[model samples]
Target: MKLRTWGFYFAEAWRGVVGNGLMSFASASTVALSLVALAAIVILGANLEHMTRMLEAQVQVVGYLKPDFDRRWSDLLVQKVRAIPHVTDVRFVTKEEALDRLRSELGPDSVLLQAAEDTSNPLPDTIEVWVDKPSQIPGVVRAMRESVTSLDSVDYQQEVVSRLAALTRAVRLAGAGFIALLLLAALFIIANTIRLTVFARRREIGIMKLVGATNGFIRWPFLLEGMLLGFVGSALAAAAAWAGYRWLAAQVALGLPFMPILRPDRVLLPLSEALVAFGVALGGAGSLLSLRRFLRV
Candidate 1:
């Protein structure tokens, strides 16, 4: 398409919006609201998944050695765990360390425990294994159980690991479903709004048809109009989402210092770009679909 022709289409599209001001505003608002909802869900899910992965990194398998197990075999087992793929860190905790930990945890009862320390601290020497990936847990556990020379029992937060995995899957499924519903709603609203625009200008379209205007020529203006509205609406939604995320981050920092809650700049920027592209495509598709039935030429 030539620059002049493109300009003409743009002009006509803008004119259409100006001619039907309230209808156009309503359509744009519909698209904006839908995009905003979709973006919010996506941002929330992304940040949460990031935080959960961080939490998962803190999860570890504590392999307690038998009381009679040799210290050499325990050291060997710790080395083997450290060599496992995705294993981040493995530290051997002696029975003494465990006893000390227990004592500290008991607080006021520490003095009594110290007095009876000769009763044989039943705590076993253990190895705490941490991995980079959550999926590595089962394999690491199996390897330690089978390949390790000494391990009485492995104690890990199985419930937490399982629930986190399940939660990640649920979040993905729910995010997809929410986005689909919002896009569908946006399409319907844009189609109805554009349908009215086409109806109000039915006579003008008939005249253009008589003047030898092709289908492509008639379609371009509506498509461009829809795309323009989508772009503007998406920009507004992105701005609102960013501001909301900033506020959320501040609140998290103030109230939950220990919790993992970083600003979502990396996640949100790409998502905002995606939202703009998706919104434009949806609007153009909806406008074209609506205009076709009414144009009939």
Candidate 2:
């Protein structure tokens, strides 16, 4: 389309809003509330995903070597385990290294450290495998036990791993459901808003139909109006959600010093862009459906 044609469409859409100020406000408010709920869900899903990842990162499977195993066998085991698809890192912790770690954990003032140093260090050399996915650990452990001969036993936190897996699955399901409901709500709000606006201008539409105006020409302004309403509402919603996310981040930082809350900044721009696309798509869809059903001329 030409620039002037585009400009005219925009002006007509703007005029529609100006002509029905109250209806416009109502439509914009509806869009804003629906988008705000969607934004909250996105933020919540993001945090849950991050927390799950942190927990997964901390989980590892340790394969302890037999007491008389040669150092070369331990190296061989580390290399074989590292070949696993989701394995991120594999480290061999020697008996002396384990004892040193235990000593550091028990401070110099600890009598336990002295007693530990005096006795024969019972800690065995082990290969610790860090995996990218919690689900991969069980398979990797099984494969290592079958393939590697020097390893005595594999140990992992079964309860923690199981719970993490369950939590991840539930969060994903809930997130999908929330997003689907929010989109449906947005569609209903926009369609009803357009219907009311069209109803208020029924006489004008009747006269236009009686005259030479085609359906497309009559439809352009209302469609553009819906688009504009959605865009503005989504912008406001994004701002509100961003403010809330920042405030929540501050509280998290103060409350739990150990947990690292990801800065929402990383996802803000992408999320904003997604919202704009969503608004445009929803607005266009709602306008088309409403006009087709109600504006029969």
Candidate 3:
């Protein structure tokens, strides 16, 4: 299209928006609200996923050796555990080191160590196993149990691992469902708003058709109008989401310094861009759908 024609289309689109001010505002507000909700879910899901991964990375399988096990086999056992396919590293903690760790954990004045000092250390030698991935931990634990005959017990917190996996999956599924519902609601609202605009302009569209205006010509203005509405709403929503997320992140940092929260820069930029794109696409789609029946004339 020529520049003049494009300008005319945009001008008509602006007039449409101005003509139905209340409807346009409603449409835009709906889009904005939907996007805000979507952004919240995305941010929450990302943080939950991060926490899950952090927990997974910290998972370790510890195997305790038989109480009377000879010290001569410790080095060999460590080397063998390290050789396992998914095992990243294995370290043997001697009874002395274990006792020291207990004392440190118990604090400087704890008499628990003093009472045990005269007696042989009751703590068994332990093999600390680290895996390349959390998923490999179970297999590594099983392999260690089967291959190491001297192992008296193994501890990997199986229940915790299973619960974390289940929680992550549930969060992801719930997020997906909620996002889909919000998008659908936005689409319906925008489409209905554009339909109203089309209905109001039915006579003008018919007149244009009689005057040899192509369907494309009749469609462009409404499409642009819908896109403008979506753009405005999305911009507002993105701004709100960014500001809210930043404030929340600051509060979380202040309240829970040890918890790992996603930084705004890492999340907000991409989220803003996505919201903008979604808004434009949604607006265009709504306009296109609403214009079809009118264009059929």
- Number of the top TM-score candidate: 3
Residues 1-297, candidate 1: write the lDDT tens digits. 789999999988898788888878877887888888887777766766776676677647888887788776666677788888778899988999988877775664566676659688877888898877666788888888887756789877656766866776787788789778878888887887778778877887888899999888888888888887788778888888888888888888778766676566876788889989987998898898798777775
Error of 3 at 9 (Å): 1.5
Q: Summing lDDT over every window of 10 consecutive residues in candidate 3, give the lowest-scoring window.
A: 50-59
In order of TM-score, best first, we have 3, 1, 2
How many angstroms is residue 24 displaced in model 1 relative to the true structure, after the best TM-score fit?
1.5
Candidate 3 local Cα displacement, residue 239, angstroms: 1.7
lDDT (tens digit, per residue) of candidate 3 on 1-297: 799999999998998898889989999998999899888888887887787677666638889999888999989998888888988878899989999998886766778887877688888899988888776778998899889999999998656756867876887788789878877877787788888878888888889999999989889999998899999889999999999999999999888876778899999999999999999999999898888776786
For each candidate, give its TM-score against the true structure: 0.76, 0.73, 0.79
lDDT of all the models against the reference? Answer: 0.80, 0.79, 0.86
Q: How far out, in Å, is residue 18 in model 3?
A: 1.9
